[model samples]
Target chain A: MDWTALVLSLKLAGATTLVLLPIGVILGRVLAFHDFRGKRWVEAAITLPLVLPPTVLGYYLLIALGVASPIGQAWQALTGDTLVFSFSGLLIASVVFNLPFAIQPLQRAFEGVGQDLRHAAWVGGLSTFATFRKVELPLAWPGLLSAAVLTFTHTLGEFGVVLMVGGAIPGETRTIAVSIYDRVQAFDTAAAGIMSAFLLISAFIAIAVVYGVGARAVRLRG
Target chain B: MGWAHARCGSVAEAGPGGAGEGLAVRLRQAGPIPLSVDLACAPGQLHALVGPSGAGKTTVLKAIAGLYRPQAGHITCGPAVWFDSAAGAWLPPQDRRVGMVFQSYALFPHMSAQANVETSLAHSARTERAARALALLTQVGLADKAHRRPADLSGGEQQRVAVARALARSPGVLLLDEPFAAVDRRTRRRLQQDLAELRSSLRIPILLVTHDLDEASALADQMSVLHEGQILQTGTPEEVMRRPASERVAEILDLSPGV
Candidate 1:
């Protein structure tokens, strides 16, 4: 097992999950409650990265951040460095790929919080933010937590996006997925098998903890 | 000192249900439509609105509570303009000092019984909120259940918590929506007596909406019969029953010559 690549994968997954959690909450609540033009289109757009070909996504990302595109130039000017072929770039790619995993469950959960509860809150003189914090958030906590866990695991397993954009740079963007790919490509089946075993065990442990906590919360609520 | 004393004397001398003494809610929503009703509950009296389901009885209550925006009408409670569609003056529910006990008992299921009651107090100190809530629970005979959740309580217990919550604000007008319907028969009778006692102690006009005439007669000092979104008659229960303003009122009252 490549310890550095393993640590890098963990860090990337952790960072992606942390960044996506608040964004997922906002997106889920908006999609669940708000009525607006182009909402369906907006939802489709958010989900597109999940289904889009990873190579095509990587190509677009590569081009957009290659210092030729206006966005890339602007970003370079702001950060004094290019985002392409970096750890940060891989993190961004993983978040985009796993967004739907973080959002769909939460949106469904929030939608299930019936309008009667919200109407009662309105009559009670609660402001919109207060109602969300006090009513919607508590009701949707289980699904939101599950979404977070799912996105984290999905990000950890992400290979195609990281491979194309991250370029498998050793110790910088060489996540465990890319490291395993490297071992396979080099015909080192033993190392590849070890990495695969670690990934499987870690993914299983993460999912088990998530479901365990979610089940406990549901039981308590009942 | 003399003029002030004289003024106080004249104010006190006015008879019960005198001009500007009780709530007057006459509201119209939209179009040429008009939804109007009038009542003068004497101090320390229970007034009731009895009607079949979907008679717009809840509308009338909501209008008075400032939850409804009427097209045209005025609601005056005592000297205050709760809602005057003509004058365009409206007071919010919180400002009106009106306590409402909802039909579903709308107890905050998340909070304990005491906290639910304490919600009525705007400026209640943390220490006093619990004490005052407990006192109200005791008055409603649920002091021992103050720490219990509404879900843990029986239907009757939930209703008592609702009543205690309504009284927590010391409202000038208490609106009860089928307050006794949820409780079992034994609890209902006990609650009825407790409500009557509460009415006397609070000395506030009570407006209760119910479909049951027996319950209305048992509790109301004044009764209004409504049918199909209109008031058929308003009078003392005996008078309304005996000399109904319309045939519908008579039918609704189920009045008989002997009774």
Candidate 2:
């Protein structure tokens, strides 16, 4: 099976999850706790990725991060490398597309921590950062695990966005899903089958771990 | 409007043991739990705010703890001026050395009773925090269950943990909001007695918000009857019960006229 492609996918997914974790937590907290003007619009904008077709998302990213765009120019100026059809470009696409997966669960988890507990912590002399680290993090760890697993799994299996932003370039941007597609295109169904099985097993194990740990977290929070 | 007329106005009588400037509070609001409160609880005194559920009693307590801020108010405790709307001065709960027991207890569900109390010792010497937490837990008679989480403890036990956590800071002011409403009668009586004893040793102003008139009469050194966000009268519970200032006060207290 395409081992390099498998490794690339794993690295991309790991990096994306690590990059989005802190951003998701801060954004999720703001969304969960505060109510201000235009809140619904902001929520809708973040949620658009879930409903938008991967092709549409990819097309937007292609324009936003393409060589002709300001971001692409700045990226090239900073790194002396083109962004389009590169691993970095693909990584950016995966991060943007996975925002909903990482943030929605985090927001729900933060919301589960009621106002009484927060007020209690405040009166107990816990500062904002201390309260988040001590109380919010411990109580909402299940949601955090869910966010990571979902982001990783989704990145592994993504096809449309990967093909659009990250072409099947061996050992660079080529991921397991793209390799499987390339295998099928070359009439090599056997190799594609093995890669797909590997992916299936990876996803099953991830989901299983999430349920195993999430159940214990909920029980402990009681 | 005037301190001399109020029985609780003996601010200068604070003993040397009493900490700081007691608590001075004046608040006004038109909506969102409307409140017009001008009250004082001298150092070493326990003052009860007695009113119905919607009468801004808890709001007043929350305001004192820096959990809620009214539109216009001035709150000063000990040497610190907590909030002054006119001067744009305000301190968040962490900055205000106030300990509070919420109605729901609000103990960290994931932490043991001892750890929950330790959360309030944020400014203490780290090496001595555990001993101090155990001491507070012992004071509340929950030292045996120090390692038990809130869910494993009974309602009374959880409430005790909440109390221990509140006192962990050696606060300048202590606030309790319907602290006994969630516990059984036996637990309630125990907590009441504990508070009665605690006040004498704390040497800090203690404010209790409760809807139960009997609770106020039993535990409060001075009590204020509040209605529609306003203090109708402030006096000894005996004085308020025996001679309510107005018919509204008598009605609020469920006292018969001429009694």
**Per-model TM-score versus the true fold:** 0.74, 0.91
Q: Residues A16-91, candidate 1: write the lDDT tens digits.
A: 9999989899999889988899999989988888889888888887887677978668878998877777887787
Q: After superposition, how far is residue B103 of candidate 1 from its true place, in Å?
A: 3.2
Top model number, DockQ? 2
lDDT by candidate, in order shown = 0.77, 0.87
Report iRMS values in order.
3.6, 1.1
After TM-score superposition, the amount by which residue A83's alpha carbon in candidate 2 deviates from its true location, in angstroms, is: 1.6
Residue-wise C-alpha lDDT for candidate 1, range B45-128, written one tens digit per residue? 788898777777888887776666677767766777777666678776656767778888777656688877776664466678
Which residue pairs in model 1 clash with each other?
Answer: B26-B73, B28-B71, B28-B72, B29-B71, B73-B85, B75-B83
Docking class of 2: medium
Q: Could you tell me which residue pairs clash in candidate 2? A: B21-B78
Query: In model 2, which regions exceed 4 Å deviation?
Result: B1-9, B12-20, B31-33, B242-259
